[model samples]
Target: MKGRRITMPEPVHENPPEFLRNAAEPVRDHLLGAAPLPAFLHGADQLSLEDRRLLVDQALVLLEQNYVHLPLKTAMHAVNPVQRLRLLRRRMERQTPQTMPREWLFHAEMSEIFHSVRDLHTNYLLPDPFNDKIAFLPFLVESCTEGDRTRFLVTHVASGFSAPGFEPGVEITHWSGIPILDAVDLNAARFAGSNTAARRSRGVQSLTVRPLVIHLPPLEEWVTVSYIDLAGTARELRQSWQIVENLPSFVSADRDTAVSQGLDLDGDETQRAKVLLFAPRVVAQERAAEADESLPDLGAGEIATSMPKVFRARAVTTPSGTFGHIRIFTFNVSSPGTFVAEFVRLIRQLPQGGLIVDVRDNGGGHIHAAEFTLQTLTPRRIAPEPVQFVNTPLNLRICRRFQGGPGLDLGPWVPSMEQAVETGSVYSGAFPISPENGANAIGQQYFGPVVLITNARCYSATDIFAAGFQDHGIGPVLGTDENTGAGGANVWTHDLLSEFLADDPGTPYTPLPKGAGMRVSIRRTLRVGPNSGTPVEDLGVVPDELHRMTRRDLLEGNTDLLDHAGRLLQGLPPHAVTITEAAPADGALHLKLAAENVDRVDVYLDQRPRASVDLTGGQADLMVQGAASAHTAHLEGFEVGRLVASMTRDLS
Candidate 1:
């Protein structure tokens, strides 16, 4: 035979190469079509075979596992060698995927599998693969980007002896040698598999770090600390920033890429702690020197600062003579007036000019923080905007839990509201009644102009705060087109599928998987806009002025943010009105109101309006209280909702 062409059947598996056949077997079974893990995991170490029979056995077992969310419809339509071979052959012809290393290749396949199971955006998928004991500071998720690759900027790095290459403010572009974007995507995708009871039954990575990168930021450098210190530090950071810490995500070096290289496997799987690979841009001394001048002034500053624990405020006098201020508040807040006292103290130090509230790299804490922040800056009375929740089946369940038991409430209207919960509507807004968001600051006041410097890293409460500033014509916004991260709901996390499983217990409990939990969007928040349903989720507060990060800006760290705010203050609108004092008389009250940008103030008793006083002079006294039947004061802005306030006296 001079020349001949020989044909051979392609292998049955398109993913994971032949070397990973053994390692990927359980995963394949759990996700795709395979038998019960216990059935084969027992003898898996010695069950290597090049024949299609092994794949067929695994597929048969998968069919029995009842992976409902998978592509397969029923056991009758079970997987077999013939079907898998055909699928693999078809896949191979369509795309000749890169022959990447075992790590990347396997991870890519797992990522796809995870997305196929559930939605990652709404679910928690971070996996902890490294240290069991660790701390966390909020890394800027919204600002994490370099083209398509996301880089996490360490506002503050977690303490303790971490892996090598650690520092504050160093932008992390990778995690454990894998790019951070890919790692986060993979980690998020895997946990998405735990959407429901059935999927969670087989879902191993949901809320797990193993087999996926759970830790959002890559490890920088190793440092030493005692567990006591670690515990306190972790709690301190978590409490301060309201951040969640992830366990390390790791795989032993032997099981990593060893098979392809024909290396002997290490028997000690748990002994070897993996390491983090830092980005060359941040870590390389030569690279830093090259871009020192261009990027030095960028947002890089004191990562580890003496700013309280999480909130910091200080007056900054840029080179210009104009007086300005910078305030960075990390935690959104737990209550409305939680930070009022601190905020007032911060503002009191600033000279009358634009105040820069730097909410860069801040993760959301509390929902009321936005209004609470604005209230401290403006003494005007503003309307309490209402938020509507989409009464989706899932949301209704969460609301009901929060709604609490109807067991033995004394309130007369409690049962009626409970009945409404029973007769749940599709959209909560459709109903005549919805909860009005309540937040008020009584004494704090700042009448000066404010410039909000935000990055894509700004978050939930930041979104609300930014939008309020613009909506109320408070001042100019710098650093972005709109606010960065949007707030969808007040996130309340529970262990595993507790939100769904506690009452129903959808599936029988197996071993509780490690480092897994759920962050559920319990209540939907609507922002102030033309549309009552306008959500901060995607349409974050678009800035009144764009301080966008340009290519050059990134190189130079956008040092001009505060400088721009200072410039805007040159033409800032002067104070419009003021609430001077309230004097009680008999069963009535007299209020002194000063108006320059004079419009009108709508007075109210117990949130119910009593009078609308149009300003006739620079100063006037208006009688607001009558008989003292109800003790409340309300001021409505000039036809607008801005400059409004609702005040009430404690009868007790």
Candidate 2:
């Protein structure tokens, strides 16, 4: 799909896939049905007052026993979820059976208590109807700065749906009867956001799309939106909320794969929803590409890659320099190795002078993918962030129960937690989730100056990735907001939790009365390097530079944002270290290498230091004995005794 360029008054592009007309017809009808909810939603068995009390009690157990950030949330927010849940149960007991509230109301009350924690990783997933649906509008609204004021603009409108004069770039002044920005703030107060930036960003995003699994559907069936047309004329239109199926698949982590995980389930689901609404052509292309291993037809400068959903790369030409720009939409991939390998391949194909990585709305996926990707950008040995469990007897038993299981092995945490009984430690000893060797296995693949772009919507694994970048001294981080979403924990679904504790009858965990479920932060993450031991929750990684989104940035393919990143890249020094040739000859190693801004090269054979070669005129040739029999060769480039680049080559 060719991306549209900025034009004066016309909408960005009108070429939506024709297939959407037929595809969206039934969905729209279902949304406009007479009933407030679908028939399937009404079929659920009503829960008694006791059933509601049991559900609250069950969720409270996880919070008190397994939640890693309970103390932090309590200390920071001054809200006690456990106390609140207990009170909810007491209130349920006092009510007569005939006066029992509806099951959805009970679920909403429980969700409120969890949302008070301000942790997206922890949530109360509603039952049946709500879990499998999403509430969305036809278009998305985003805010951009104009001098000292912030303006709300219609960024994207779904295909097969149209609001005359309500196209992209039109300004939205009011929502229903309230001011647009005021409505966003009011909505932001209902969700879980650890910081102000995150709250506002999420509020803006939820204005168009909301996954019902983690959030209730919109209460109002229709909204009258007031906006200014391209001619600066005031206009008003009423649009109804649409209910559509939201079935996003999650790949679980095992010992052999991901070390730790931080995922935003709602964000993951809504990402697909955004594509389905705003870019249906891309969705159709994704299906066709996956079926036949074909490449999607991308716009000008956009790289054609197999993993189109996870990565979007283009060779951008800016005023500073023509460099590579890759936008990582999400980290929700199944294979971390393939994720990193493909990333390395993409960078090698782009102009090597500089690169910009944009992860603005990335709600993190696998921890391994985020941590391991860091080593490819810098020469420093990667230290994966450590994770620790809240010290408690239940956590100790849970660790022992799944020690050698295929899924989670809390065994490593058991020792410290057991020792905590006598030492009175509040948390288990921290341990790295991804192994250090695995992270550095590929070594540095890109040696050019690089800059990362982030926003408040960047959460979970993305937070870890940004943290590692800053901690390891990779490059400059440019953020659209002051900080990330501040979600830094490994989240596990209630289904997985039930499976782990199913065989143990002594456990209080049982299947919910309905299809209701919950997710909790099982392990909290800690930063490494200079910021060692600092928790990533609540206090997320602060960027080195901040750039507010501009009018051109929203309407012109991030023109201003990329310009800012390009300027940052131009100021930084670029380095290149390449081993052009390496081979065994006459019981010795023959190597030809090229270096830029490097004075010396260090060689390690099978991880043991073998030789140090001085560079002359940015080139070197060396012959060393015993290296011919080594299984691996490691190279490090240094300028003025500071290591700037590294590479690893297999000799076996």
Candidate 3:
């Protein structure tokens, strides 16, 4: 933590606010056995002219053949990355002076070509030092709205750092002598985002902490910040950037299977960086929880759960009602079963009035994890978002070769791709990234009214989760932003790409220089139901209602935002359908089922209609044939023929 302090003012209080105290806690500087903050980074220029050509040529091959969103990106941005790369290659070939420039310039050129597409799924990963490091200031800043105006506030100040009066809730007016908003816009332009709102939001977020994998370090060694303190006193501070090595690794399984190879490459690194910057205390708590399995429950309505890193559950009482609130930090977990099971246990602990599932700032991971979690909230069949690949000869080759291979089954897509050669279709037929039956297998776990809260930082698998929530008519979606990050493609690493770039003669395959790597969007996702066949890229999931972040939301514990969502929940009807017991008796299934706010119960065995019974008392014993062999039993509770509450159980 090295910096130049230019000003120091009196503290606003003898003790700082709790939010300030929580924000001031330092992150584990030695994350993943990495080094402490370094005063300066090691410098080197190792990229040769030949290395540059290899990188560019490989990038071109991916953009032309493996990238599924190329057609969409070309149409949306009106840019041809293929042509741009060809021109760059030509210039490199014609140069008389063979001397190589700085490595960043070459990396920047390659990055810029992909950035033009505005897709985070596709990127040019810098090698070694740059790849392993993250740059950060020891604080976090967020925004809130005052009527028509938006204000930036210093929401956090890292521990051991001295900022005097510039504590949490201090209004930031300027950055590096430029107006704060203008500076954010300037920084936003350098990053990749699918829309203007996403770019600007990410811009504000990246102002303090940037993962060097996707962004270059700030040119200025330090930044000058000007702001107004809590007492309306003006102040200035200079904060220097600190470098940390070995960002946290988030290697997850494929659909919770043991097949882990070729799957760990899809882990979300940017999400880990955000977790380090925004919620270090929570991260610290998670680490502590992991270290000690018998860690006591977090009081203040916090629920005890197995997955503390992915889920933070609490029973929140709002003006509308007492509801179960779960802040889903990220979907970057290995087992979807454990994730959803923990979710089910948490919701069951709270009052069934309603549930507010918050996925704000949740950079998504694992397609199956996100899609499989959707069935827990709704009675309707969960139709997982369909995925498509660009119709290319090389893609066909990879699909044909890797069909039924380990952790990489391109089988379902092969047939459609084979037919595309004659149909002249630009993309293969759409297929769900997750199995449809797996999505609907668990059925509805939460019967109360539900609402999902989202923001612009919601991306990839998070984007899919939001879309599935809306597409399935589960409940209203309340958003702090107009749309999600709109990253609709399944990203594949250069290692996966190499599987397609085989070792045959005359193959356009070469080892990436040094530790350099690339990731391309191999499959584009499409929406289901009403928006079926529509791409989820660029056009992200729009919220049913929008709530601006109030000052209370930033300074307090999202008090107003929860209140808004609670009121929305109040309007929707609530239902209760609990199955207390189930067993096979004689030749039929018997059960103790409880129903509230419903008059009828329709039973289905393995998705086949079995029997319909009237709900007279609150509880009843249910019986149907073939229960011994049936794998699942779905009970739909309805009032006057209108479905309200649904429950599913495993019969075997």
Candidate 4:
């Protein structure tokens, strides 16, 4: 290999080409065969647009069929020469490599990427696989182009300076002895791909607004971490970024665990394992564990992570039996076993009547939370929808363990499954819910009935939980339209493909219109309900019953959904009540309450307890001295306190 300082010119737009932005000479040579590597890309400033095209034309010819993917190779011949040339031209127009040409990216489409194994461009790097990601850090920090006019918002760990004058969250104008924008922009330029997964990475759950990750490499004096801005816009700057707001830390962690697609299998995709961009899950995990040794506890242990007390176990007396009540705000800390343990305990303490699971504001967390809950609450085995990767060469290679080899039993792939694979555009089969998933579940099933409640806030994994309940007709769902649960199922992104846009040794990489490497839903989630084969990602989980929260419900904390659920579980009629002949004068309140199966009326004016009036024969005159205000009356005596028939009226 020719030794050269692989530097770029100033375009003052003078940046390393996208491929070189990620990879460098070594990777280029490995993929390009004996074709002479470009002499000096830094001199591109003097080259005219046509001159640049000539250079690209030559490179294209040299790479004609040498390193092309199987699908692309076939297409290259199938298409006419004019179309082929046009295709190549479009690639050049989109990919602005400061100097070198892209081998696997920019020009490469997502569909094209799937049917092809990554050449040396995105895969082969750093001599050591374990430390490959660690070696990639310097490119992100140091390789930005000097004098390029670009702006970036950089954040740091502590409230200290990341550079001498460059503080976190401040606009970095210069970096590493150069005007920083170009570097940030040049570095940022690589991630310009148009991937939908990246666009939809909003509402992602993290322990806090900013999730801090610090990595210390072995035998190295320096330590590195990924703070923010994998894409040009930092997450905080993005339009759809969300944090674990108003959620307990455990709940956030649980959802984070689920969203990151953490699995319970004996692998590194656990709560603590930190994987780097594009590295194989197995290797990145080992290095993360190794690097974790040097990290300070950083208050992780100091913070108590006990389960949040979300269950309100009260069994109200019903004609047949008692009805149980439980409210869930989120599945943040709802780990499969962790949540199941609490579920088992709460259900054990409840009366023999059916249960009401109030999931109003709960967005979801891990699927395992639902899985374990299913295992503990029901006797049926839970089966996850088949999650298959796209039919790309890299995916085919990665999924080979399931495709072939000694672990063939693990994969459900075979000749008979051809129709399913072809129809689904997927190469693998669904995953059977493993026993390890329900390790925390109680063996017995709950014979009592269940009632589910939801709203728009009942989203994501909560959608999964609701679907699971519907799968078994476990209960009636309330507080949502016919569209039912959140129409999103579990999604797995391709950070592997995403690595093409990351900062690496030879080339700093990214797709066009940069920023966004988050996961996409490769396999739509298949619901286990009667509508088998129908994905919840589209129609969502249909509800057995429907109800919605009114504006007053949101403002006044109405439990009408809960109330409706209780009545449904108890086979009782809807208790209707009305307030009329109302008058508020001289700080005195008087109202005629016409009701049925009523016991008494508890009135609260301006949220303060005011007075109570005992009812007789479902009628009472409520006269109480109070201020002129909006009053709420709880018209009760339906069954237990569980059944509260209430009404709201303004006494002005």
Q: Record all residue pairs in model 2 with backbone atoms less than 3 Å apart, i.e. clashing.
A: 1-297
Give me the displacement of residue 498 in model 1, in angstroms.
0.5
lDDT of 1 by residue, 85-170 (tens): 34533443444224322322322332343333232223223323311322222122223334654334433222121323333434
Q: Please give, for residues 1-652, the per-residue lDDT of candidate 4 as tens digits.
A: 0112222222211342333234332232221111111221123123333434443343332233112222332453242322344575666676555543532232233213321221111111111111111112111121111244222333222111123333333343343334543433433222211111111111111111211111111122222222233333322211111111011133332223533232111011112111111112222223233445322221211111123223334555434445666666445453455566666676666654577777654545456665557544443445544333335433443333344444223235343245544576433455432233353334333445577776543454566677777775555777544543333444333333234224444322233121122233333345665756655543456567766543223223334545567678777333435576777767776778876555666665665777766678877786677554555543333334433344445554
What would you estimate as the lDDT of candidate 1? 0.39
| Model 4 whole-model lDDT (C-alpha atoms) | 0.39
TM-score of each: 0.51, 0.92, 0.89, 0.41
Most accurate candidate by lDDT: 2
Residue lDDT tens for model 2, 603-625: 88888998999899999999988
Candidate 4: TM-score? 0.41
Worst 10 residues of 3 by lDDT: 1-10
- Model 3, which residues run further than 4 Å from truth? 1-39, 95-98, 252-270, 296-299, 404-407, 500-507, 580-592, 605-608, 617-632, 650-652
64-140 per-residue lDDT for model 3 (tens digits) = 98898888889878989999999989888975435656777887788899888888888888876678667777678
Model 4 per-residue lDDT at 460: 49
The candidate, 1 or 3, that scores higher on lDDT is: 3
